[model samples]
Target: MSGQQPGRAGNPQVFQPLAADDPTTVAGYRLAAKLGAGGMGKVYLSYTPGGRPVAIKVIRPEFGEDPEFRRRFAQEVQSAQRVQGLFTAPVIDADTDGAQPWLATAYVPGPSLADAVVAHGALPVEAVLLLIAGMAEALHVIHGAGIVHRDLKPSNVLLAADGPRVIDFGIAYAADATSLTGSGVTIGTPSFMAPEQAAGRKVTPATDIFALGQVAAYAATGTPAFGEGTSHGVLYRIVHEQPDLSGVPERLTELVTRCLAKDPEARPTIAEVIRLCQTANAETVLRRPEDWLPSSVAADITVRAAAPAPVQTPPPPAAAPAVAYSPTAPVAPATPPPGFGPPQQQPVQPPVQRPGTPVPPAQQPPRPYPAPPAHAHAYAPTPFPAHQHQQQHPQPYPGAPVPPKSGGKRGVFIALAAAVIFTVAGSATAYVLQKDDGQQKQGSGGSAQGAEQGKGNDTTAAGGAAAGSAKPNAKADPKPADFKAINLTAGYHLTLGDDDVRPQQGEDGGYELSYDTGGYLDAETSEGNLVLLDPGQEGSLAVCRAETRFAKNIYLTKLAKGRQICVSTGTGHMGLVTVQGFSPEGSPSEYMTLDVTVWRNAVGTGSGSRS
Candidate 1:
């Protein structure tokens, strides 16, 4: 395996300096710098004792506290260690019993498929073919070890000089083990999920095949096959709509389509996918060319592979203060590190005085660490403040007299007198114009009704007609009443039928409510109809009346805050449920809170609506 050299110069863009809260060393290996962070943990660049570089992933402390997660994590690490192939990064070491579990993998110094595509557009057809073949081989090895990589996306694949390397098995699980869906959290990326995976059904090796199709399409084209939007919208399309493969090259279209089949049984296996790639290339063994990647992309990989400088820990303060630390105590201000953290405020200083003049009270000396210069690295050590470089003025001749002030007080008085005269003259002109306008109105009509008509005409001519016309309509369309906020949990059922709109626990089937994985809330009764509104649809009774189709389940995973959902109850009442917020992620007591507004009358009698 190729890796970065430990003694080379670093590129600030690739390797950020360690943060104040970041640890300098984990176990026996010394952390060189921060690589990046993800939802579950932070990845750091480190060197082995033999001077070969490795990437260490430290799991988040919250996840470490969960006993179930710890058990699953250890099992996954053991399985990942078994996966060995030419196109995969192998797990080198791990410690699952520590306070914070961490695993180390051989670091492949190259830009990810996602970053490369974003930086240099889509890859050529030849490059994409190689990518698919390499990824399919890696998946074969992973599945051979009885593991399923639940989260497979473009970001997890790295582009190496030799071939593509698949990395990051952080969420993989044994194929026969129980899933984590019981906790109401779906595990895979929304855009690349298979139909069964999006519906929270059984995920098999076929699930990764569906993701492989999406990845190939993305590599050939610059956008996702299902297109991009909210997670709810993307997942819905993946489950119900056909993928958009318009930009996919004609030669690879059929094979990619087969892998994306909605039915898992219909999709091809990993072995067959490899066969198709070989057939398309017309080679029993696809050999890579000397210039496999585009010139621009290869140049970018070369720049990122350059090793970064080792992080130097700042020395501790020479004399410590005697104050004890407390959680509630006000924190003393410290200078922010070079490139990251909030910007520091420069102190306000008094104006400079002449040498002969008495100085005002002197302010405290400037802070030892000054604000960083523009474009500094986020994690670099703070540099010393630059010396003041202001050029000094030559001293005046000893006997020379100071120049006299020019028009000091008299000029100010004249300007004020001129402004007063202009103000009086302007006010007189305005009074004459007002008097003339009144005379014209009186001459035109003497009756109050006629004068009012004349005023209306003038207002219309001045483009203020909408203001006069809009008031009555606004008054006629008053917002509906009976709005209530309901809190729903796993065992609760939210009833939108009567005046009272509250969630009840353990109701019968007619009024039952169940929350499932992928943000699905099921109201499994024959009485009411539910429809998730389209993006930007207004949340109102009228929208519910116009909705012709209703669903048994509503996916709220990607619904934006304040987005509306239309629903009709068994009691012939219509309502719009707005998502207020959800419980903190990974919380044991996970729940969703909704603000529902119900109307007494039901409108259209389409599919799910009650007459």
Candidate 2:
């Protein structure tokens, strides 16, 4: 083992690039070079001698310390093998019980959502709508299989030239399984998590919807829903506060707003989201993205060939082709022996191809050979059967659920914690609510009656307003010619509960801001700009005060990273508002406020109370 350097730049051993000759084979496929690295592991550009390419992921050393993590990792690998979708990066190979466990999937060529936003700023409204619809469709398939991609954020979304594809199901959830991150800590990125997930409660499809909303916010404003902040601060806001959507495009604001709803139940289903996005026409998507092609093809026909062919019963020895090698030919799996607790999983062996055959078109780039049939490997129950192939521990095949090891300390602790929390939290709330029901109902009813009367008065007032506008100078306030000319600068403070970064000031004196809100707040600016966040529970409003007239519009677009800062028009008047508080579950952004607008008339000007 090499000695490590603490934090110096020239730590010879830190992130050294892999040499061409370095052994990087997985299953029978050889790794050609290193692609990139992240928190969990290093990603390699691997290919079979036949030329098929794959992106292989190798787990990092730190994660290996926890046995529980390893177990969960192995399970996730198996589950990934079961996923089948054109938009999904399907698993091609894996070896969970090897010295250094590794998994491989067909390589995808595209920019991540984060990279796209950084390079191109926000996408056009139409493109954003397509992105949302495509992503929602992808999630529909994944969630249906009973898997929850606990970490769905911009980085995880790959915007291929053709369309969007989701990657990294390393910590995905199965239909009936506990999350890899148990109680006492959060797992997925803080910004993209649903409110309940932040509270360490159970997560479901609604949680995914919340994450999608954050993605959409990024599309609109080049930011997340909760705004940029420390992971802790972002989580705090997601669980307790609302998002600020001042600049989101009117077409996508509603869709993105729904995605950011705090109550998971209130969020739309993935399929519904897809439909809404398609109909929104927020912006037009470009052409379909590129697709993968088989690595090798016959020179004359251009026909595709399989990476390596599947195993078949051997016939006469004389029938063997020159390239043919027996399974017992003794090729070692890539990587060295382990020094850790248990051995990592082994990679699958590459299949043997038939001589002179053209590669199948389906075996192209994004597409690889179909996954190994269930139980293709003989090392299920026991991870490493290398030195001795034990017979008694016959393991179930891949796709078959692995039983939880009985009585693991971590499992016991989790179960106990869950029991205690549920009993107290559930019982206490039920008891209190039931006891207060009678008095609460009476008060609630009275409030409802009063609210109705107030609505009637507002309607009457609106009618009078319309009539007044018809006749000039009827004592009604005149709409200003333009928004107040406030000279804008760089620093402006806008906060949701407690976020650190604030909004930037525009050269024109106006400020652009955005926030993620699960509930609506009829916020009145001291200067007369009225902004609404998540109106009616899951809605968005774009408010801007240009001159003396205030303008607003209801927004309706699914969460995508390209629809923020759209102008407010059509609904009432005309003004521009930029998105404000953007945050995701795992990686939320910081909140920013600008000098935009203020409502002239509202009953309460002091207390931050709800209407």
Candidate 3:
């Protein structure tokens, strides 16, 4: 596959630097990176000498020389020129009769529908509806020009921050063009083809509707309507069998079923489809909110930067609640992050600094009492609400102990409960965290061990020793904490996708969230702030006690608009970071912010994700 991937360079890693064999420029535009390559030819990410981004598909040598293909290509280009729709990636420029036969379309910055579903499973019902409607609208425009988009499938549709866009009309034909599928040189996909197209019969606009049914089924159920198999079998099923809508939702079954009808006249027209979609979804929004994609798929939106563009503000510090411990204390009077162990020896001073010393980002120093090492098992005491007198550190002087109470039945009950609740006659302040869908299980990504496995090899800093180093005072491995969460929408949704929300640079040693692909969190630059971490290494997240580096595998997939993730500010305070939401239906406010709850001091709780 040599042709430029038309329009999308969603995966930043896939955008390879220009090769020696590649052209310095195409037509007049300068080629930046290779977008895609296939049987057709290489597609390059280019800039019009005017600096406009475009996916330029340069046809392969063999196809360009075919006399028959040349005529068909020229006519299709003319047909493509007549299409213009909010949902279609319009063909802005082309030269079908030129030496290489190239075409350019406006760039859509998110992953293709296929890539999104493959990486994150089925899209939500609302997302699928919007997709169907958008594609239907695009078809309305496509057919208006008398063009039949002969090659319509998931990959040809991109999930942009704005909406879905139809791309790659490589096999499209004018209403009167010759067949491109008959006589063995099939240009369209078999699983999604119309019966007429599969039987080498006349192709028409309804051909696209059939494919739309297949695409919708795939989007809603994460599988094709026609089962997967060899080319011959799939096409055979398309021509003579009933579609399997088993996984589709009930309301949509009727709609897609009609589109997949074997008889062209029986299929719904593009206009009818738009009307049906709007009627069925009268409550739906014509356009999706900015946080339209899951973080995993959003990470693949590489046409622009996808990282959060926050200013370089030093993350606030975590406040150490008032509490103190004595030498060789046991699990007695302290509240911890969860999964903490009782003290085994002399009181250990947590790494807390005076007001003048600089602190790291995304972290808070553990209370200045005996604490466990990164891997040490910890005993978490119940939250001790502030009010009762308690020491902030191991006190040099001892405190009084409460005598067992003796009274009547009612007073006896109170005495018994007080004995279980109090220790050394003290009360301490407790820190409260929000909880939502419990700790968001990480995203369904390439690997679950990415972060957990790394923690095993991570060096611990307790007792002034690195993770693997031996320290006589190193605390034993603390049991992981029960991560807390809350809906990101609790803080009214923040719409940062607008171009006006530019990113602010950081100050010395402050927290910074960066993205390899641009627009990650620069809502304007990248529809949202989504950073795709390097696949094999530790990522930069200011979790833990200030400037704690996060492991690669702990990231979540979908981040909703206006959601905030709170972590230890490494000071005595917690830092709350909010990422923009892009949910199509704008409900269930999922926060896509970097979730530090999963890794308080890199303990690695709830490290896996559900697909």
lDDT of each: 0.63, 0.47, 0.53
In candidate 1 the C-alpha lDDT for residue 245 amounts to 96
TM-score (all chains, Cα) for each model: 0.48, 0.43, 0.50
* Residue 361 displacement (Å), model 2: 64
TM-score between candidate 1 and the true structure? 0.48
Candidate 2 vs candidate 3, lDDT winner: 3
- Candidate 1 error regions (>4 Å): 1-12, 170-187, 309-611
For residue 542, give model 1's deviation from the true position in Å.
79
Ten consecutive residues with minimal summed lDDT in candidate 2? 297-306
Could you give candidate 1's per-residue lDDT for residues 26-51 as a string of tens digits?
88778988877765567889877765
Return the lDDT, model 1, position 538. Answer: 65
Q: After superposition, how far is residue 478 of candidate 2 from its true place, in Å?
A: 77
Pitting candidate 2 against candidate 3, the one with the higher TM-score is 3
**lDDT measured at residue 149 in model 2 versus the true structure, 0 to 100:** 79
How many clashes in each candidate?
2, 101, 77
Error of 1 at 47 (Å): 0.7
lDDT tens readout by residue for model 2, 410-507: 33333333323322322222222222222223332332332332354444223222222221111122232323222222233222222222333322
Clashing pairs in 1: 10-308, 17-379
